[model samples]
Target: MDDGKMVRALVRAALGRALRCDPDRLPIGLKEEGGVLTLQGEVPDIAAKRRALKEAAAVAEVRRVADQLHVKPAVRMGDGAIRDHLRDALIAECAFQECAVRVRDRGTLESVRTPIGTVRGTIDVSVDDGVVTLDGSVPSLVHKRLAGALAWWIPGSRDVANALEIAPPEEDNDDQITEAIRAAHERDPLVDAVAIGVRTQSSVATLYGTATSEEQKAAAERDAWCTLGVDDVVSQIQVVPPTAPTRETRTA
Candidate 1:
């Protein structure tokens, strides 16, 4: 009825339109005052949280969106355990072993890994409660996305703010998404990188080819979605056991 209420209503309507659902149907909470909006709730996944923030921020009446939305982690863990696990995952990756990686503990930044070669970049990792924030610079978008994915995979990471920047910024497109997916698959032990093929158009990745097990097929698809820039994924991966040599169907 008043100006503030009207603005709030408009913002809700915009979010409803963007999400293609009734604002009431959306589980997230929205609070707006003096044009600053804060979103809070548990979303199903990272993608939904990101979509909510993007759509809410586009509202004409909203100044900025404070993201308090959290993804319910699959496994619960303490901050210390999460920090240790995340550090290990990053260090194990050959791409990141050359980068200076540090994790924040207590009041100081603790060194996790010293660069093996010339310093490629710096990666600062910090965890608060269940939220993980990645900052600093990386050499490529693939590295950035990989780091984000690794963070999200952590059992206690309720939210990940991937603020890592790429030095000598490269153009990001569907091709980059495809490359990242392939790289992820190569690193994933469950997936046969050569067996699962990726093709992307407009950020939608179509994964076709043959997989040894149903788990492998599913893992390959999940890897595609975890990569940055992948909006949607269509899994055309056929499960072919090692004994079954017959080719089923594949997407071109």
Candidate 2:
């Protein structure tokens, strides 16, 4: 086989091994050309689909991954059934136990209500077809992401629209916001906080620095965007390969 064909074959084999443990994703189809991998076939939920893409992208020499996988629940369920399943999952999670999970069908609100006197915050869940929408407020960005992940994990969920707001403890100044962004970046293993400069002005966070890859750049932006009180994020970050020489080094 030619070099191109060999590379593609190697990528396929690597991806297959990566997903071998997950029976639900074992049937996913993979095709690679010019280092770009395309995923086909169906998975049970959005989480499975994301896992497949992540596994494919981790293969050596993979430049990009295109997701064409569909979400097909093992058993067909109505909107009501899907909502109940999501509610049970949310209430069982320690992080979400204090939050209410409401379900809506299409644009119409469903009758499933969390009791009248519940004091905890509200998290509204809407289901249309298999797609889910999460709205309301959470104490932190972590909770918002957790809620969305839970919703996406449901068997029948095709996608998730997470609109959950993060309730800031108090008003934060630009400096505090910048510090928060920096802390978030430092906490994330994928980001190199030392290389990234964070600044906030008028509730907008701006990031400046060079990242080793597009994924790292995006992770930095996400960290800034998720910081409390950050109204917007302006990413001035550049993607530079690890082997590339820096201008400062060249001048020195």
Best by TM-score: 1
Alpha carbon lDDT at 90, candidate 1: 93
Q: Give the runs in model 1 whose Cα sits over 4 Å from its true position.
A: 1-26, 32-38, 47-66, 212-214, 241-252
Whole-model lDDT values for every prediction: 0.83, 0.69
Residues 1-252, candidate 2: write the lDDT tens digits.
Answer: 976666556656665665565433366776777667788877654435655666666667778987677677746777778788987777767666566666666567653446456445678887777666788887766566556656644667665667887776434468777876776676567899999998889877889999999999977876664454565677899998788668998999
State the lDDT of candidate 1 residue by residue for 1-252, as single tens digits. Answer: 987677668767876776678987777887777767888888776656666777777777778888899987778899889989999999988889778999999969988778866988889998988899899999999999889888877877898888999997988988888888898899888999998899999878899999988889877876786677776678899998887334553332
Q: TM-score per candidate, in order?
A: 0.77, 0.43
- The residue pairs in collision within model 2 are none
lDDT of 2: 0.69
